[model samples]
Target: MSFTLAIVGRPNVGKSTLFNRLVGKRLALVDDQPGVTRDLREGDARLGDLRFTVIDTAGLEEVTDESLQGRMRRLTERAVDMADICLFLVDARTGITPTDEMFAEILRKRADHVILGANKAEGRAGESGVLDAYALGLGEPLRLSAEHGEGMDELYHILRPVADEFSERAEADAPETDLDVSDDAPEDFTPSAKRPLQVAVIGRPNAGKSTLINTILGEDRLLTGPEAGITRDAISVSLNWLGTPTRIFDTAGMRKKARVTDKLEKLSVSDGLRAVRFAEVVVVLLDAAIPFEQQDLRIADFAETEGRAVVVAVNKWDLEEDKQDKLKALRTGFEKLLPQLRGAPLVTVSAITGKGLDRLHDAVLRAHEVWNRRISTARLNQWLGAMVEAHPPPAPGGKRIKLRYATQAKTRPPGFVFMCSHPEDLPASYTRYLVNGLRDHFDMPGTPIRVFMRSQNDKNPFKGRKKAPPSKLRKHLQGRKAD
Candidate 1:
């Protein structure tokens, strides 16, 4: 029964700050730079006893064309149409400008219940702007300092009646039912709903990360154009993707570290890296015409090193002339360049035309399945014996190494620990041999496989110690008679 409120305004008007305040979490990235938010982000919000849904949208722009700013403006206008109420934010220090007036007029035409808010109106410097907000004919403006947590009481008061009205309407419209004094449950709540799968899309600049996300969403939800690095903040959107609940993050294109000098770009890259860390499946998007650049390899390698399930998606595939030949070349190059990711799915997709999306979805799911693949101890031991017999462990310095046992220590980018003699002396080449053996034998291709070597001697608590003298056990035995 709670109403949905949308915060809409021009760039850098503190809308995201107010949204963070309302949600009581730093879900949206905030910066001094304008146009930080590029998509619609929704959060469950609470103000005192009133609970509702709040949406933080991209900043309103004046352009109405096909440019990026125009697209952003259209998206913001869409939010106005969708929300039950609109909180129009204006920069009080800057005073009511032509953009604020335009936004007000738009809200007057579209929004059902509009609440004018003069943000950053804490000191006397913004007092004139707060007064000017009233002249827009939107009634009294709620003076707010979203960052400083001022005027929230006024915001709550203004929204309380609207919430109550929604509650009453919902109650009146509901069918009568038997009531129990202790029974408190939502009528439409489903307890078995699974958590959404986390997927992050990353690549170099202009690799169609945003376009792919938009195609999947089947709408112009994200601000996308020909611009490189159009996306920042690593915005995440939720959807039921082909019967699977998924939370997919759209990240800013990450360039080489040497090229990332700007402070904002550094933050954006950091955010993208964070998204990759939390993501279960990372889609390394690439340009079809220029696939597998050094940067692309690094991005995919980062995901692999982080133990994330990886899917290499070559975007703009629709532009390719010879599809079959190009696909063969791509596969050949993938195998030759990235032996660690052998057998991992490399799906060709067109973010614009939505070509081969279904195949990409299947590939992603398959990679995740392999990432979480687990083997029984008996099976692992059997496989280890065969692998050792096929290629015996090398002897070093006249000492032979013995492979005692192998067991999977973790799933989700499956990690295994091997108990053996002289594990420290084992060469990394042998480890790679075992890892590749495991991938081919267990059918766990493409996903990163972690192998850890542990020595049987390592289990001893007195390791690396000279015992400091005779053991206390020996002393006690000496003291004891012939017991």
Candidate 2:
């Protein structure tokens, strides 16, 4: 059971700054503008021996009305409530403002435990403001500057205890169950033998999805241009990235149905959708100026609905006037609009300039890792047992659904084969329950997840030896008769 920690504070206080630092990647959108962050983003956080789930929440806004701002605020509060520990950040450079205090009071009321962090506390200038953070009544503020990589040791100190406490509770509360899956375990469990993670780079016309692919390959392999929809076919390229061989699909740009009047464009769009279906990881690229269109959200939702891992790449980040603010705004928009990929990856880069390419690859790998993740049969069956105990599989025709066992059948898309009494009779909702369980038990959120139900007695059709050919059998019979 991974522990969850949420970072909450007023806008532009470097909440995302801290999140990127902890996750060891520029996953969250960061900018200098206020209210840029709109949605809550979660990442697998590692600090020394501390491994926990960290959520980067939108900056707290004081809006109570039923407007868009108010809805955004409500969503941020929900994120804080979901967290096991909230890292409440205050700007040491800006001092404790009214909004900071308001957010603190809100977290104190909602979060079970709050860890105070006075961000931007690097030089002598931030000293006075760090002192002001104590007035929030949260405890001694942990002084650190997220942008400069300052005071990380202090963060570890704060995180270790919470992680340990949660780990202990989870262990103690774990239920014992008798569901078994040893018979279905794969003969080869080697990571090398697992299929390469399938990744799709998709975006609107001229969003530079092809450029990014070419850059990743370090060659002029993928066709690129300023024109829209040049690539008609979804091209797959297999390569090794940091020792991990990944199969990347460069897809056609997805355009709106009304705008897609040409037959070629329609075929291209269908090809892109097919790539999405086959992919385990999907990277949605955006032109920095025209980010977050309805079509982009639709493509992202398609990936989420299919259980594929998703990442957002803001192409042409170098050309943007307010780079930081734009990235933050993009992330906020994604979280608010697409909750299906709640904790998806968002990376800023310039495909032409090659800025942030390394970070992009790192993000893809992390997303792939989550996409390929599989939990041990023991853990999954244990979780399944608890889930069944809480709400037993619903019975149709007065016969209860009997799930005999569960085992991971394949990797790339993180597929599972569940042995049941009657696979065809299992309801769609029951399968969803198991899929949700797999997502929760394993730290695989926002990745495409797959579940396949199979009958217990199902066997391979190609097993037994073949008899002799008719002509050979006839000759053998003739010889036997002669003898």
Q: Identify the candidate with maximal lDDT.
A: 1
* Location of the lowest summed lDDT over 10 successive residues in candidate 1: 185-194
TM-score of each model, paired residue for residue = 0.88, 0.46
> What tens digits encode model 1's per-residue C-alpha lDDT throughout 45-74?
989999999999898888989888888888
- The reply for model 2, stretches above 4 Å from the true place, is 1-198, 219-223, 236-247, 274-280, 304-308, 321-325, 388-410, 416-434, 451-483
Q: List model 2 lDDT by residue over 203-292, tens digit each.
A: 888899878877877865554555666566666777775576777887778888898996656766786788888876788898888888
Q: Distance (Å) between predicted and true CA of 71, model 1?
A: 1.4
- Give all candidate RMSDs, comma-separated: 5.5, 21.4
